[model samples]
Target: MTSRAPAFPLISATGEAMRRLGRWCCVCAALLAAGCATYGPERPGEKIYRDVVFAAPGGHKLRMDIYVPRQSKPAPVVLWFFGGGWSFGSKGYHVNVRDLTTAGIAVASVQYRMSHTAVYPAQLEDCRAAAQWLRDNGARYGIDSTRMGASGESSGGQLAAMLAAAEGKSRIRAVCALYAPTDMVELAQLYSKPGRLSLVDKFLGGPADQKLDVAVNASPLNYISRALPPFLIIHGEFDGVVPLEQSERLFLALTDVGVETQFIVVPGKRHWFRLDNTQFAEVSRFFQVNLKR
Candidate 1:
């Protein structure tokens, strides 16, 4: 017969061909899995972004980390600055820096002037310039510049307050300040009072120095006007650095000018760290309404 007892099988060749096919399939699956893996700490509807050059103040280029939500067509933006007595702090802090992106809101964590180099209005100018950056680059960043807000803590909080109090047409929509120093003159005076509890001296320059005027120029309480934005102030009752009254004073000043402001006092908390779930949730909700579409 023509079949000739069947053809002798090339067992080794067939086996090797099957093995190569299996290996190729496995490699494809692995590549797909890698692509689908975790993008970052970014949560649903959020993304982690960085190093967006927001401005160039004093011939120096400034940068920020922006988190944009997927749900909103044109999301509201929250421009956040970190707290370090105006001498230190990157655009990363409060853990809020990351969470803001996941919540479907756009956030710009900024870097401004520090004490060792620039002070007072220098910081304010940088901040104002950051706002302008947001406004100018809103389309590129997927942000709704018309509904922008600001938030920060301690010296960072003071910067947020200043953003709200700035005299401009593109005013901030809302503000969130945590343990911010409102009255710089008052804080500067307290620096030499037997203790260094109020240490804004290094930030705005010392009271003994010509920094007194500089301090006054930076205080949020100095520029109270009806054109200010709504504010939410969170202060530790025992915050030795900025004092509880600072928030109260700023809240009152905003309210006096028919602007909306809310104050939350964290009992027994220190100048650094210690925000409970309630405080965290409060700020989160505030930003949801104010910073997210």
Candidate 2:
């Protein structure tokens, strides 16, 4: 039999392939480690539970970061949703947890399905899930489940209203909606300018005129009733995104139903307001008065 030369070239090729595979594996491992990394800073003196999976809708895990006050007694909790017109936003950013927690209240910064994932009630469903989770398991985290409230800014503000309106089994005792779009149909009209993807359309999956029922159903105004919890609606006078009338319509509708509501207009301010602003104090006070024992 003819002797076969040692397959050194094959061995070298195999060795090179193994090295490349090892490098790729390291890159993937680093990415996964980063994915598991904690985000945002936790306020001092409060215990924070991050990435707590509250619900798994459509097999997708939804999480909330719960911040519990250091108080001995059970503390009231507020379900806060961040805003990016329901298209994009994070539970970590634009949070008022420190302010609320400082007032001896627990804060559950919740994550909801965005318009890109699902529409209308999907976002509301995730929010309601968080509220229900807090209501059920909050005591373990020093939360007084009986005094639960909802608050958010911009699109999240509208969600807070919807959640408070659709109280279901978990009754939200109070709501604070800042610069939220209350009337979707009207908002659709205001944003009818050509060449733009309206946020309302993104939320409802089409133009409000085409999806009238969905628009009406998505609107917090349509769900208002005497049974709703107290609402504090704050809008910026120069809020070019969601018109001032949106908040006014919601306030007026709530008042017509004899529901307790307050509408505050901040002069020269646009959509995003400061956490240190006096209006934010009103937010802290709203929850304090309505939620605190």
Per-residue lDDT of model 1, residues 109-181, tens digit only: 7888677677567788888888888888876767888778888877788898888778432568778888888
CA lDDT of each prediction against the hidden true structure: 0.68, 0.76
Pairs of residues clashing in candidate 1: none
TM-scores of the candidates in the order shown: 0.77, 0.83
TM-score of 1: 0.77
| Candidate 2 residue lDDT tens string, 1-293 | 01111111111223443343344334324333443343666667788998899999898899998888887899988899877768766787767544788889888989888787888879998988898888788888888889999888888898999998888314788898888888777666655535545666778987777888988888898887888988888877766566677787788788887777777878777666655557678878878888866
Q: Which runs of model 2 end up more than 4 angstroms from their true locations? A: 1-39, 168-170, 193-197
**Model 1 regions lying over 4 Å from their true place:** 1-40, 95-98, 167-170, 193-199, 205-209, 291-293
lDDT at position 42, candidate 2: 63
Query: Cα deviation in Å at residue 30, candidate 2?
Result: 26
Clashes of 1: 0
